[model samples]
Target: MSSFFSRLKQGLSRSRDSLAQLVPGGSVDALSEEEWLDIEDGLIMADCGGELSGSLVQQARKRRGSSIEALKTSMLSMIPDAKEINTSENGPFVLLVVGVNGTGKTTTIGKLATMFGQQGKSVLVGAGDTFRAAAVDQLAVWVERAGADMVRQHDGADPASVAFDTVQRGVARNYDVVIVDTAGRVQTDRGLMDELAKVRRVISKAFPGAPHEVWQVVDGGTGQNAVVQVEKFREVAGTTGLIVTKLDGSGKGGIVLQLSHTYGLPIRYVGVGETLEDLMPFNAEAFITSLLPEHAVKS
Candidate 1:
């Protein structure tokens, strides 16, 4: 397997280890109803969310028979599969990446650009976060690292105009992908959200049915608040997908389940570490299995 998958698997293993501590296995047959409630509490503490965890426990109780192994096997099947990207055709697959400030939105874009470029696709980045001079400079560093072209204007330029120019350039050059990096503002801010909508409209006008994907980047460390963030972004930007970052740092990674269940947005990718390759496509089974204790895996 690739190093990215290996790290993903490893990171998941840590999460599983944490989860195992919450759900101790005694023979379920020997446990009281109170014991089962304890197990459910563990799941909730893992950030699995009450609805999903409760549903899972109820299902497990109904189907209980022999080994904890069998129970875990069934439970693993409950998590949804990761979202897959269709990179089949060429000619400008545009991704509009957004997130709140300090959510590592620009860094995620840089990594994504590198990944696409490494796959032999031509990429053009749009510096659409015109409010911050640093945003443009940071993305420029990514452009250089990824060896992809960028569309940028001076600081304080209209972000929608930047997006317009970026899409125009993409169509003219027949670029394989155009990743637009937008400013990460609070989704509740009506003015900023309206501006984002304007950017989308500009892109659509330039290339109808374009802005092929609107991806929201959420910090995994933010816990349940990330869910609120996703909901707000979806309301404003009509997000089609999610990218959860900082999974390697905290035990709150269980928020992935909450995101999948609440938003029904497929997790396209996860940020595990700081390196470019740290980002990996989400794998639900591997992820859930990784959350199990080493002893559970062996048992």
Candidate 2:
């Protein structure tokens, strides 16, 4: 496998191993009601949604067998396929990122820009998070590190205006990618969400079918609250995909499965560590297998 895929496998293996230790395996046929409850509790503790955990356990009960292998296979199958980005387009690929404060939206943008730059694609960043001077400065640091171009207005400027000018520059300069970082706010803020939608509208108007991706960045450590955030953001900005941050810090990586199965939003990327190269593409099979017991892998 490619190095990226291999690193992803390694990171997910760590998470899965941690989860398996929380609920030791026994023959599926011999699982007592108490043991099943323990299994369900383990899934929830791992940040898996209760509904999803219940459903997975129900399916496993129906397919119960003498070996743990059968249970592992069934559990792995419960996870849906990971989503892939469509980089096939010609012009600058614009990604509009949204999320609440402390979700690592700015950091995620910087990492994404670095990844695109490594591919030799020219990138431009829009400091659309005009509400915070710190956010603007953070993105500027990323621009320097990634060696990508950037557009910014003074803090407190209209964010939509910043977005408009950024895309206009991208089209004129013919940059390969344009990433706009928006102000982080709770999804409950109707005015803020409307403003985000307005920014999307502005970008689409400038370049039809542009703002190609609306990615919501959620904190993996937020647990079930992340699911609520996804739903609210999707309704507001029409989020096409998700980038879950801080997976290394939280045992709640299982929220990914719930987000995918609940909202049908493909998890395009996951943040395992803080470095620019730490951001990796999501792989469903590898992630599922990582959650299995080490003995399960050998058997």
lDDT by residue (tens digit), candidate 1, 95-123: 88989988889999998999999999899
Relative to the true structure, candidate 1 has a C-alpha RMSD (angstroms) of 2.7
Query: What's the lDDT for all of these models?
Result: 0.79, 0.79
Where is model 1 more than 4 Å wrong at Cα?
26-30, 64-90, 296-299
Task: List, residue by residue over 265-287, the lDDT tens digit for candidate 2.
Answer: 77888887787766877777656
How high is the lDDT of residue 250 in model 1? 78
Error (Å) of candidate 2 at residue 8 is 4.6
Give the local distance difference test score of model 1.
0.79
Candidate 1 clashing pairs? 12-290, 16-291, 16-292
